[model samples]
Target: MQRYPMTPAGHLALEEELKHLKTVERPRITQAIAEAREHGDLKENAEYHAAREQQGLSEARIRDIEAKLGGAQVIDVATLPKDGRVVFGVTVVIENIDTEEQQRYTIVGEDEADFKINKISINSPIARGLIGKSEGDEAKIQTPRGEVEYEIVEVIYGE
Candidate 1:
C-alpha cells in the first residue's frame, strides 16, 4: 500500500475514531447481539438482524480507519519553515476573481475534508491548483461547474 500525506490533527482524529470504535462501540454491539440472541428465533428476530448489520458496518469502518492510519505520513505544518506558500494543513484565504467573494479553506487529508468546515482535500482540484502558490498568486481551478480563478490573499500556518 502506498503511504499518503495527512496532517497531524487529521491523523489524531482518525486514531481517536478507531479507539472509540474498538473500545466502546465494539463492546456495546457485542452486548446488544448477546441480548438479541437470548430473545431466541435468530431468523425472525429483527433486533438480532439489526445488531448484526450494525456490527458489520462498524467493523468495516474500523478496518478502513486502521488502514488509513497505518499508511498515513503525518505532517505538522507548524514545524515547517514559513514560506508563504500553500501547503498541507495551511489555511488559505482566496478571492474569487469574477465575484470578488472571499473564502478561507484549509487543505487537509481526504479523510478529514469537510466542505462545511472549509477543509478541502489536498487531491481536490482547488487545493491542487493552489499548492506551491504564494500569497498574491493567482490559481485557476477546474470545477464541476466550470473553470474558476482565485487570487491568494493569505497563507496561514498555525491553528
Candidate 2:
C-alpha cells in the first residue's frame, strides 16, 4: 500500500480516535447488542436490528481508521529547517491578487483537511501550487470559479 503523509498532530488525532472507537464505542455497541438480543424474537426485533447496524458501522469505521494509521507516515514540522518555503505541514499565509484577501492555510493530509480550520490537503490545487514555493512567490491556481492568483507572504511551522 502507498504510504500517506501526515503531520504529527494529525497522526495523534487519528490515534486518539482509534482508541476511542476501540475502547469506548466498541464496548458500548457490544453491550447494546447484548441488551437488544435479550428482548427476544430476533426476526421482528427492530431494536436488535438497529444495534447490529450500529455495530457494523462502528466496526467499519475502526477498520478504516486502522488502515489509515497503518499507511500513515508522520512528519514533524517542528524539526524541519527554516527554509522560508511552503512545504507539507507548514502554514502558509497568502494574499489574493485580485480581491486582495489574506488567508492562512496549513498544508496537511487529505484525511485531515478541514476548510473551516484553514487546513488544506497537500494534494489540493491550492497547496499543489504553493508547494516548494518561497515567500514573495506568486502562485496561479485553477479552480471551478476560474483561475486565481495568490502571493505567498509567510510560512510558519510548529504550534
Candidate 3:
C-alpha cells in the first residue's frame, strides 16, 4: 500500500470523522431502514428507498475514510527541517509579482487541502511550483485565471 503524507492534525480529523460515521451514522441509518421496513409494502415505500440510499452513501464514505486513514503517513509539521526551502509541512509566504499582494500557504496532503485555511494540496499546480523553492526564488504557476508569478518571501518550518 502506498502511504500518502498527512499532518498529525489532519490524521486526527479523519480519525474522528471515521469514528462518527461508523458509530453514529451507521447505527442511525440502520435504525431508519429497520423502521422503514415496518411501514408495509416495500415496492412503494419512499421511506425505505430513501433510507437504503442513505445507507449506501454512508457506507461508501466510511470505506473511503477508512482507506485514507489506513494509508496515511502522518507528519508533525513542527519537526520539519528549518531550511528555507518550501516543502510539505512548511508555511510559505509569497508575494505576487503583479498584484504586489502577499499570501501565506501551507503545502499539505490531498485530504487536508482547504482553501478556507490556505492549505494547498501537494499536487496542486501552485504548490508544485512552490515546492523545492528557497526564499527569494520565483515560481510561475498556471492557474485558471492564467499565469501568476510569485516571489518567495519566507519559509517557516513547522510553525
Instruction: Score every model by TM-score.
Output: 0.95, 0.94, 0.95
* Leading candidate by lDDT: 1
Clashes of each: 0, 0, 0
Question: What is the C-alpha lDDT profile of model 3 across 25-116, one tens digit per residue?
Answer: 99999999999999999999999999999999999999888898889988886877777888888889999999999999988888889989
Candidate 3, TM-score vs. the true structure? Answer: 0.95
What TM-score does structure 2 among the candidates reach?
Answer: 0.94
- Looking at model 3, residue 98 earns an lDDT score of 98
Stretches of candidate 3 exceeding 4 Å from the true structure:
none
Compared with the true structure, the alpha-carbon lDDT of candidate 3 equals: 0.91
| Best-first order by lDDT | 1, 2, 3
1 against 2, candidate with superior lDDT:
1
After TM-score superposition, the amount by which residue 101's alpha carbon in candidate 2 deviates from its true location, in angstroms, is 0.7
